[model samples]
Target: MKLGLKIKTAREEKGLTQNDLVKISGVSRASLQLYEADKGNITLDNLEKIANALDYEVVHFLSSNVVPQSKKTCPPICPSIEKNMSPNMSLNNICEFIENDSPLPPTQSNNSVRIPVYDEVYASAGQGFINDEHITQHIELDKGFLRSYFGLTSFLDLSIITARGDSMLPAVPENCQIIVQKGTPREGQICVTRIDDELYVKRLQKRPKYKLISDNKSYDDIELEGENYEILGIVVGLFQKIP
Candidate 1:
């Protein structure tokens, strides 16, 4: 049963009217009505208030069978390519080979395959060839190798792109290439953001309100609310090509 329905059922079983529950819970009457009608779209704080008022634990209103979405798994590295890799091979060279060569299908093995690096392509942040943007680089490595090399087992999908704008300077200078990963941004995590069609890379802060911070004190933090902003991705790594 949905949480709303469960809450309504429990309240009915306790022989409490919505108004009585509101009085006990200190929750607004409209909120109590919403709860009983199974339309409880409330925040965690409000939910706690309702639970306290009902004389029931918060867990009692939740479905026991709820399962979270599984984390996406990385494709296996190709053994055929692994055999040819030399100890002296740099990350750039491996990327080149993966982009240039065609190998076995991903379903055949647990080996690494190259993930194509396409240009800008309207990524939710970072810099790249905008619309007709071309591929500037291709990174190839087994997921295991990348995890070991970066010392980050929690890394998700990684995409290479150049940084744009002076908004996130000093810490992440313009033109610096970055590797972005798909995941939730923790407080203080540097992330790429999409705010009303504009992109920015900034330090993220999540309070009752969201804020985008910059290392340069001159730049003010951008507060985000409603549907105007979203976190595109977290920056996991950076690289700079030498001439």
Candidate 2:
């Protein structure tokens, strides 16, 4: 059942109207209405308010009809999640327990932080080629490796983009994976940006419009007229793939 219907059902079972719920929960009427309409997601705090008002626990909604990934349906991970677990238990219970108890066991499996690797776009590190934007996959890189190699403090601010062509050359090599961060750059800072639907890793200069520059002398600077460009991310660190 939709979360909204569940909330509405519980509230009606408790003999509470929307006005009564808003008065008891201290949540705004519009927000309560949105929750009932199933328009969007709500925070745990707000969920607690509504759940308490309806005399039901938050997990009741979850465990009642929760399926993170169904075995006969969409579970590449669910089927192998917990083989020895009870059949009566649903995925929702596991999640509910995890939620109530913060900080899951820090397994070595999840110790390495994950960063998204984009296959479609390439920074012009070698020769120039245009590609579409897509996230090919994600890899859990060792936090120690990231810290040692890039002096990075947080994985939350990092992503991996493959470099293709050599417009960046000596500074950025061709066919390398570069770490990117979304941040406002100083003028002349090397950044990963997009123009005309093509992604590029280039030095940026701000004028009335934007100017994308290449480190290699062979490629001329591309003047981006009007608002036809976007700053995707700044190059933080670079790595080579071992064949």
Q: Write the per-residue lDDT of candidate 2 for residues 1-243, one digit (tens) a residue.
A: 566888888788778899999999988899989988988566556877776676554544433223222222321211211212111111111112122123233332433665554432333442112222334334445565466656777667567555557788878876555778777777888887665445677888887557888888788788887646667667778654222
All candidates: TM-score: 0.47, 0.47
Tell me the spans in candidate 1 whose CA falls farther than 4 Å from its real position. Answer: 1-113, 123-138, 142-145
How many residue pairs clash in model 1?
A: 8
lDDT of 1 by residue, 23-74 (tens): 8777899977776676756644566676656554342343122121111212
lDDT of 2 at 203: 86
Best by TM-score: 1
- Model 2 TM-score, 2 decimals: 0.47
**60, model 1: CA deviation in Å?**
55
